[model samples]
Target chain A: MPERAEWIAVDWGTSALRIWAMRGSEVLAETRGSEGMGQLAPEDYEAVLLRHAERYLAGDRVTEVLVCGMAGARTGWREAPYRAVPCTPAGEGAVKVPVRDERLKVRILPGLSQARPVDVMRGEETQIAGFLAGRPRFDGVICLPGTHTKWVQISAGEVVSFRTFMTGELFALLAGQSVLRLSVASDGHDADAFRDAVGDAISRPESLGAALFSLRAGSLLEGLDPVVARARLSGLLIGLELAGARPWWLGAEVVLIGSAAVAEPYREALAAQGLAAELVSGERMALAGLIAAREVMA
Target chain B: MPERAEWIAVDWGTSALRIWAMRGSEVLAETRGSEGMGQLAPEDYEAVLLRHAERYLAGDRVTEVLVCGMAGARTGWREAPYRAVPCTPAGEGAVKVPVRDERLKVRILPGLSQARPVDVMRGEETQIAGFLAGRPRFDGVICLPGTHTKWVQISAGEVVSFRTFMTGELFALLAGQSVLRLSVASDGHDADAFRDAVGDAISRPESLGAALFSLRAGSLLEGLDPVVARARLSGLLIGLELAGARPWWLGAEVVLIGSAAVAEPYREALAAQGLAAELVSGERMALAGLIAAREVMA
Candidate 1:
């Protein structure tokens, strides 16, 4: 192994794979590829990685390769055990596994977990750590919305706890494939209907299970405009999330990490709960997590 | 018009077209076709109805035609007003409209509605009334589980009030077409997983919105077997229904009208709620509805 390596970190997620050769906090070389874990084949995963590495690293000698996120998941290279919650970047340890050849050593970061019912997360832990990297002193709630929406709470830089909501996945199912598909308009926001539905959802949250039926009932009874039903569904789902997460997050400050389109509704939902929040780009957090993982490995 | 003609009733559901020719309470002939309103062009609707009617009648003369279900809605042949709930077999009147030549008089049954917040039912109301037919007096909750499920409170041969659930539609969307489709096993039922999920959904009814996340999370965290997730989803949705309906339905006799396979889970869900329910065939209710609708026109 070389005494020192040129590149510092690599981050892979659901949508894209990104590599950063960092010298401390500064990036020396960066390369991106279309190798999201969802699209990779198990047999050719290593080959795909090598191709991307060759494109970016050329012949540079590297001592270590650290990966965070889905690539370390069961679908990716290897399944890494999850670290239980009430964890922090400083306290959490990286799980190091040797790569295929002796020349390369890879450390697959451990994900976060909750006991009792037993819930866990993989890539998001790194993102949480990355979010903490720049704002290490910050504390309170952090929401990462996507296919599986995460509502995380942090205290003194440690991830105290978190819960997951299937907002995005449900939205996709309802809007793309369900009967409601006939009603969903374009992707643009419908603020009025969104606010109305969010309000209804939060007020009588117990009715949420029954409320879902309204999407069909509304259309059947009153010719519920499909666009409105779409917004109502979005509202009911977010409202349920707020109702579930609110008990744990009454007065905590909220930091939302995701794309603008995804994060905006959540921001509005939180605001409906009378909780104010700040928005942080998910890309930056991934980058931040890559940097943190690198530092820990160093 | 013939001096005395037999009764003809038509059921226009979302998928198929059914016609019944009845003399008093006895059904003389029954025929089905692929002429659902959903598949017909607006201009060709009359032609479709006439063709189907002729095929079913086979030259038999019909005195009065009573059409129920979606065929009467704004999107149907003619817009029929909704009947406010606390409705009775006698109160269930139809809106008279002209079809083709022969001064054809067809009565479109009105849907039932609730004041204030505004909940309503269309075809299910007729089915519920039909289910109540012949019995001297039947009271309690009757559940019509289908693409749009209806939970109706019936008393003294009247539909007092009801709530709708979109269970079947959601199941089709999730298991048949959504991303979750990748996780479902098509061979048969997974009873154990179904029961486990039913327990989870019923125990913490409010957790339904969160519970859906388990489909993706289970796969991510615990190597959630796809088939199990599918069953879990089915259980969770039914569990939510049991939870919501339990408040109004505790101690009330329950009758579920639908296919045995579809209604069995609901029966199990109700049992989980400490409630017992009888399974009634949906086909019987459809036929009963045709008889009742014929009687109304008579």
Candidate 2:
């Protein structure tokens, strides 16, 4: 009477969890919850995961569940140790998360780590692997923009090196918590202002600190628009990231893999810098990456 | 038989209210409270001040209360307004607040504002006035480091020009609230680590966003000491501020006016860059500036 999952794919990050009931690669049903790794204790994770996947599970057979993201972190359900870079994003090393629910068989793919620059990524590696799955010979940089935007360099379908920026987190904190909150709107868009701020930050990267305060100052002295202030704040932070990540994006074929809401700005910013980045769906990549890992197991 | 005051000098900033029971320039009894401008509804300011100054007040005579800082802000008790820059810090404008108690005669000093860069300072102006009052012919840069660190250029007893940085605030947010919180300790100092981070940020300002994330990464990967991480985080933010404020400090006679706890890092960082900064007591400067303001009224 109810739809059953052939298998399951889960993307559990710090603040939220999303699981898809998959018939191989095609989704049969999808659901999400706020029970992310950050809020859950080591033992509390199993109940949350099972609660989300209950409707998709049958009483008789064990459903294979493949996970990516913070669920693989040390503090997650069970630690899936990080795989050193110069390796495939999600090919091997999916640590089985021992669960009491015999109806579910769970495996969390290990995240990637770099020693030199000192960087790590949990969920994005699966997306990177998914992006590379279709293009086995893909050689370029993949930019995944989110709370922690990552710039990953791919060569011969392997992640060579990567770096992460806290631009998104910083923007959230500044806009919501810092003094800039008084000057910025919670919801608004000003494309021209964003472009101008990006250009300003790129040209004078050293003035980042002063430029931030100028938003608040501009509001006080000139009655600067809250919408414009919000847009400029976003641009300045992203621009600083772009400037920091010039080595990864400059003169390289760059693909932006993120949600439209998050990835579009990077596309626009990069375009202004004379680099046209092809934008792709982050959800699709995560699914594809999970499927790729499942196929290997099969 | 109780200790009483001839007048009161109050610095009402955002978080705290510090008042001194003074006989002209000498403090007879000093007391402080948490009733700052940020928390009160403005109309509530008189009661809080009276509460702190009660023991120091006499029923027969009106006690003159001289106040500086955010208490004079637009959202503060009563808008004292701001005097545009290229002017003396605390010479002319002082707004009289209407109070219920005849025992209180309150006057709030106006702050300094810059038109072009669009900056404003309330409490710091008094400190600057104090610094300049003692050195009338001083022509140099005064560095006031705090939550919002200010770089003020002085010439001919006037503010001339100034800029503000959110370096301290940024460090606080990143170290205490952001992802780096897990890696950085709340207390500790590593001079060498601080110096290295300053050099790293100064040498490559563009890598600031990435460099910040590296501290967290370094901890996760190499067990980076939390104390070292804390120092490095402070250094990075301050170094970025220094780089941004280069125009204000380059080849200038720099004197740092702040608490030793707040000013020492800036002094050391400047020394590392071959610029020696003479550190002075912030409390003394503020009191001096308030005294100077009171003297003007006399």
By summed lDDT, the worst window of 10 consecutive residues in model 2 chain B runs over B1-10
TM-score of chain A of each: 0.88, 0.97
Worst 10-residue stretch by lDDT in candidate 1 chain B?
A: B54-63
Whole-model Cα lDDT of every candidate shown, in order: 0.72, 0.91
Model 1: per-residue Cα lDDT over A174-207, one tens digit each = 7777666765654656778888888886666656
Q: Estimate each model's TM-score.
A: 0.82, 0.98
lDDT per residue for candidate 2 within A1-298, as digits (tens), equals 5499999899999999889999978889889999989898889988888787888898999998889999888888888989999998886899988889899898888999999989999999999888888988899999999988999999987899999998999998899889999999998889999999999988888888888988988888789999999999999999988989999999999999999999999999999999999999999899889988788767
- lDDT tens digits, residue span B191-293, model 2: 9999999988888888888888899889988999999999999999988888888898999999999999999999999999999989989988998999998
C-alpha lDDT of residue A285 in model 2: 93
Query: lDDT tens digits, residues B1-298, model 1?
Result: 3223266777777677787766677776777888777776556666776675654442544456777777776677776788877768432567887666452457778777775344666677777767777563888888888777778888877777787767778778767765567666654667888888888866676566567765765666667787788778899877766666665678898888888988888887777667789888887776687677666555
List runs of model 2 lying over 4 Å from the truth: none
Query: Lowest lDDT 10-mer window, candidate 2 chain A?
Result: A289-298
